[model samples]
Target: MGEKLIYMDHAATTYVKPQVVEAMLPFFTEKFGNASSIYTIGRESKKAIEESREKVSDAIGAQAREIFFTGSGTEADNWAIKGVAYANKSKGNHIITTNIEHHAVLHTCQYLENDGFEVTYLPVDENGLVTPQQVADAIKPNTILITIMFANNEIGTIQPIAEIGAIAKEKGIYFHTDAVQAIGNIAINVKDMNIDLMSMSAHKFYGPKGVGALYVRKGVKLVSFIHGGAQERGRRASTENIPAIVGFGKAIELATANLDEYNKKIMALRDRTIDEITKKIPFVKLNGHREKRLPGNVNLSFQFIEGESLLLMLDMKGIAASSGSACTSGSLDPSHVLLAIGLPHEIAHGSLRLTFGDENTDEDVNKLLEVLPVIVERLREMSPLYENVKRGNKNV
Candidate 1:
């Protein structure tokens, strides 16, 4: 057995980088002060928070004042959707979003629907790409907000946010994006995209987990999500999590500063892994848009095998990965994203999400390639459907 554990779940969350951890230590101890206080310690804390705000703003090409901190990406998503909807209900009642959004966005939209707000869930193409025309066509006279994710969490498909934003801007509708998975991976300019609001989680990009930010464009009106102290310009209120905020800022700075290099390296490793797995494995289907997907994402389905079984085998081999399967959820329903992309329930049941990250290497890819086919083969041998197919009984 291999002594090292191979972690490839970056999309879920990243481990904190050393520098970011170092940047946070002081605030956690000696410099610990409530940012809302007026004392010298409080001023120091306030300064750190403001500096972090500026760093986050600079990373995304937004003004510092436009950034509001939240507890997590889910909070940011909830806040953005509900905040805009409540604040602008008089303007309109319809909201537009895609079918492949994370549960945060999807559930929030459902909540809004219960509140009598109309929402249009747009469908994606076979490649998991939502077209600009689809978005434009979905817009109604009552449409007040367009919320889309910058990238798909499971499939890693990058949406046409700039185009979507342009469409929303043309119609004078508010455009927001859940960019939690994309902030460190892609270039973002709020003004150029005409995005009214965006949500990002610090943990997704090597920062602390409890701190995130929501970008509300200048002049955009949104109701407060957290109501208490006068922190975060009264948008979100609580004593700021200063250490986590500092860590978040440092993480963003490091990620953006080395973006190009990181992309090149990670993409190379990812592509190598994908190519090797696909070429060597039989009956494998790659999900999502090949060209427009995230650099480190490789989602695939192996026919006639269960994803949970494969995940268990990988775990035994010290490889950490994710699988989307009905059995895993103790439900008969397959992954909504996979099914939406035209995969049959059986195929969707076998889906695996192998996301690469900073620590993955060519050796890790090769190790996965070496072990995965054997596991698939072993699993398939026990699968009745696979056995039937092998005996030339396609109907099974």
Candidate 2:
């Protein structure tokens, strides 16, 4: 082997587990059929879909009838926002969300704003947190929906979802959460949390891409996102993607079954890396809340260093990481999440996100530790900002 690829980008995507692949193989070849058809093969397809639905539902503590499969997490988010916006228009046009939400939620909210809805984008503190009091204060009588992410994709800040859920419930307003990043890494009980709707994706949890699910609680009115076949109970359309759905079911089943053990392993790696990186590097600051964050997330910002340049150097060494969320990585702008957490634009541009996964071992983390300080030192030497600060010419 040339070299193993040390991937620290689990928040972006994950490789399909062998078990998930095996579970999906039969659906693609032997059981190929249109789920809508009533023939023998069709019945098998329908059966698999229903089974997967139950698996996904039970994984998140939702009823089987409430889970609606979508093409991707983005689609699930879009449906949750637009469906509620249109159906509850007569009730209210105001929505509550945070500034650091994934673009899926932010962009959809923007689209709704153009259509005459009002949105309140709450700001986070230095550690990227919005208190339950802030959420309660933001609520208005005309606020129809409150969609906040269960965990942030960039800084891995775990929101007080249960607290906010209670606030929304007390106000009788609908609540939705984009739990895509939190699903496999954290345990969730939607019923206990009082969440009315939630979004999830399989690729974030060692399953195939292009498959996602949205949870809409019973008695909640949501207009159809797609009008076509009777699939997804007419809430969503398009023929079922049986193979991917099977993979999704298997992935969630395995992930949730041993979530605590998985978290222990990855959290060890994450904390060790943080300890080493911060202790060894000067002028490096940790991002997100120290104790109340995801198990496998370590975000940092090195003064005078650019994140994209560091990522390029890391890539050449057979390591994969991220500057921010994969959805907004293409943009030259600094992360909105970083800004919302009180980072200046220049400091935000220097952010580095290293997220862990099941496949990452201690050796991978060690390799990163070995190479990271050298890279940061080399980059800092070339930076005029560092030179000026070194000579006592300027203050940080």
Candidate 3:
């Protein structure tokens, strides 16, 4: 009866789940109390906060004391990088990261560089993968921290985090991963992964926005990033956001409850979408590793057409997708992740990213497969580059 709406940008963010919202609603009104207050309601607030902390910790196989809430994944990332960098500055000034990290990690590393820190941005292969050996080779005695993302936001490539973590562990360097894109999508044990510090955003996993957590391993030296109150064990300060924290805990609990099943379902839909699209469209390239990527991610680059044009046409068809990370979508430049994976500027500009979620279904994939080929064809017909190719112009 109405226009169909299909959303496939779960990598950017997910809508809050009903169960998470239900868990949070009471905290906003009747449970409203400052966690720092000394009253009974305040004590209740503190209890809820700690319970949420334990939930977050358990989700990632961490200890209750290790979880510290932050304003967002970006803040968690900033604190992890700068906090570790400053605390261990006496030891070394060099940090190692990948060239394809989210700006949250990349920008923080850049900021530290301005503060006299040296960062080694390791390059990835054409599939956007960096080897643990490369990390080992890049290490200098002054390398104090190794901050690589668990998975890429744009390309959906899951790095060998455990191997890198092991390398960092052997080298006695603090390892941090911006797991904003990997959390809740894949099974993660911070301990098994040998991660010293990790970052997460609740909104990426069907929890509310404005709440995230950083997992700091015991004995990790991290200088206080926020200096004010005594909150977050004197590390991060500010009044605790109880509602959002509750939601985060509940969201992760639900997400991890049946991780394998969720991945199986989403991966099926993702594969179908990829297969159908590639079969129908010519001159299309898959952006990430075919088997080693996130289950729900499908990134493709279509030749001879601009990503913006394709997105506009998909929007008209009631299909919501993305050209790159939503945080960097406003930029006209091609995605750095695409370029790092060896896509030429033209193909990189034409890249599309579709990330599925629990709510996505076969119908959604069907709609996408039905409409995307037609859209690509329509846009390419309007492209002068495509016309030149048709005319046998070899330069393009």
Question: 1-396, model 1: which lDDT tens digit per residue?
Answer: 765899987887789999999999999889988887889988999999999999999999999999988899889999999999999999899999998888889999999999999999999998899999999999899999999999888889999999999999999999999999899999899999989999999998999999899999999878999889888887788888899999989999998998989999989987887888889987898999988988888899999988889988999988888874211345546778898899998999898898888989989988898899999999999988888787895645
Determine which window of 10 residues in candidate 3 has minimal summed lDDT. Answer: 387-396
TM-score of 3: 0.98
For model 1 the local lDDT of residue 291 reads: 82
Ranking by TM-score: 2, 3, 1
Q: Is candidate 1 or candidate 3 better by TM-score?
A: 3
For all candidates in order, the CA lDDT equals 0.90, 0.94, 0.94
Candidate 2 worst ten-residue window by lDDT: 1-10
Residue-level lDDT tens digits of model 3 in 279-304:
88888999999988999999999999
lDDT (Cα, 0-100) at 36 in candidate 3: 96
Give every collision pair in model 1: none
Per-residue accuracy of model 2 over 1-396 as CA lDDT, tens digit each: 356789999999999999999999998898999999999999999999999999999998989999999999999999999999999999999999999999999999999999999999999999999999999999888999999999999999999999999999999999999999999889999999999999999999999999999999999889988888899887888899999998999999999999989999999999999999999988988999998899999999988989999999898888999999999899999999998888899889999999999989999999999889999999999999899898996657
Instruction: Please state the error at residue 144 of candidate 3 in Å.
Output: 0.4
Cα TM-score per model: 0.97, 0.98, 0.98
